[model samples]
Target: MSPLIELRGVTKSYGDHTVLRGIDLEVAAHEVISLIGASGCGKSTLLRCVNGLETIDGGEIAVDGDVVSGPGVDLVRLRRQVGMVFQSYNLFPHMTVLQNAVLAPVKTGLCSKEEAEERAMAMLGRVGLADRAGSYPDQMSGGQQQRAAIARTMLMSPRILLLDEITSALDPELVIEVLNIVQDLAESGMTMLLTTHEMGFAREISGRVCFLHGGGILEQGPPAQIFDDPAEQRTRDFLRKVSLAGRL
Candidate 1:
């Protein structure tokens, strides 16, 4: 069977600066892949490209064999299949957590309000946030807010999830709570593509780990090979820096 997601010679740029240069990747069903690199190495950009948030400058990106990065793509339908969570919890400040989670499904006519609420509540419970369903965004902690955002995305029943530094905005002590939710999703066989700074968690959770450099994949392998026995000198250098910073 074909991969669930595929990118072939994908390229992206802003003005004169290229963010992704001829990247080729494939994500199989139920696989969890982690993208690790220095800041601005194009990990987040790649995710955006896949979800049709940013148009690619060259090559192709396909989800379930349907081209999504080029012209004439049905972006709204594409987004329904691809859920993304960012570092910032972009929850509506005035909306209650449950309201925020259910809005998309209701607005898109994907489900009735009652149905949306039921799914929203169940997803909130899954993320350990059912108790906070009636709370506003400002009333919750960063971790709680992020978890609510995850619940909101999950309510859409997306085929794949893209997480972009989801824990980077939280306090150190609060990061684990959010990571635990993601860990649970991984164990439940979610197809995920994540860009993360948490190397240890990536090593522990990812089925495959990719090292990105200069807008390209410098190396990729199982977590053990990428973390413990990297092949490329650039990969080793990056890991060494992460180690010195006590982040690996």
Candidate 2:
């Protein structure tokens, strides 16, 4: 299958500090790939680059055959095909759940309000939030708010989703609810690039697991191989640290 997203020699840095180096990666259509690493290892930065939220200083990023970060790429259009869900439930508190979900399609694509609301209702239902359609973000828990955020992104009908540690900011009990919704999406054939510290979920759900460290991907493979028998010393050591810390 052709890759839904591809990167070649991608690098990103801020002034004197480099966050990613010579990164080459790809996400196949309908595949769920997880990037797992300790804090500050550039996993989140990599996810940002995938969705055009962060600009790379050099190299190329392509999403569905269109250049995303290289010459001649229209980032505005590219982003419409790639949606992002952040750790914080970045919902507009002023809008109801359905309104927040439908805003993007109605504003960016100039879709009719009625059509957008219908699409939004369907997506919110997919995430099991149909009954709460008129609730404001502030009226919900973190889990519900995040689910609303996911629904909002889904209304855009994106082909690829970038999740940047989306559950990190949630209460411990709320994490599983969000993760369960994501797992359902993965099972239903959504192409995803997820960065998370949730090792067990990564091992259980990802088609491939990538380990990043020191501004680069240290090792990557199928979940069984990467989690059980990583090839890189840094990966093994990092796993040990998170494991001993009771994070794995």
Candidate 3:
């Protein structure tokens, strides 16, 4: 089978400020790849490009062998197969967890309310939030809200899930709850592209890790090699500082 997603020479810029430079990467089906880098290294931009939220200035992006950014691709349809979770849980404050999770499937998949509700309830259980299904965002903790967001994404039955630092905005204690939900998803075969600073989680849960620096992937490999014996000096320095600080 072809790659679930591919980025070929993908470059992006906001006028003179180049955000991404000639990125080439591939994500296989059911694979989890974590993109780790400094704050402005374009990891989120790259994820946005994959889901068609950000258009590329040059190069091509394809999902499951169909070109998304180049000629003859249906962006709208492509996005339906890709779901994105944000750093700030973007739940509708007015909607309950079940409503939030079922809305997209009911609207886009044209499923009956009963079917959507069933799927949403199952997903809530998957994220360990079954009992809180009737709660609104305001009533939930940051971690619960984020997990609800993940369940909302899963309700779409996406082929790929793009996570843009989903735990960055959470409290330290809440971070593990959200990460645990992600770990469950990975274990159960969800294809995920994540931008995160949680190195321990990335190392433990990811199939591969890509280190971005100065707008592109400076180094990438399996967690053990990339975390223990990175080849690039930039990667080594960044890891050292992050590791040291993590100890504090």
Instruction: Give Cα-based local distance difference scores for all models.
Output: 0.94, 0.88, 0.89
Query: Which lDDT tens digits does candidate 3 get at residues 1-248?
Result: 78989999999999999999999999999999999988899999999888888889998998888888955667667767998999998999999999898888778755889999998899899889999999999999999999999999888888899999998888888988988888888988989999988898789779999999998899999999999999999999999988887911
**Candidate 3 error regions (>4 Å):** 70-73
Cα error, residue 183 of model 3, in Å, equals: 1.2
TM-score of each: 0.98, 0.96, 0.96
Task: Give the candidate number with the greatest TM-score.
Answer: 1
Q: What is the lDDT, from 0 to 100, of the residue 203 in candidate 2?
A: 83
Candidate 3 positional error at 128, Å: 1.1
- Model 1 TM-score on a 0 to 1 scale: 0.98
Better of 1 and 3 by TM-score: 1
Task: Count clashes in each candidate, considering only residues at least 3 apart in sequence or on different chains.
Answer: 0, 0, 0
- Candidate 1, residue 110: how far the Cα is off, in Å: 0.6
lDDT for each residue of candidate 1 in 1-248, tens digit (9 for 90 to 100): 99999999999999999999999999999999999999999999999999988999999999999888877998879999999999998999999999999899999999999999998888999999889999999999999999999999988889999999998898889988988999999999889999998898799779999999999999999999999999999999999999998779
Best by lDDT: 1
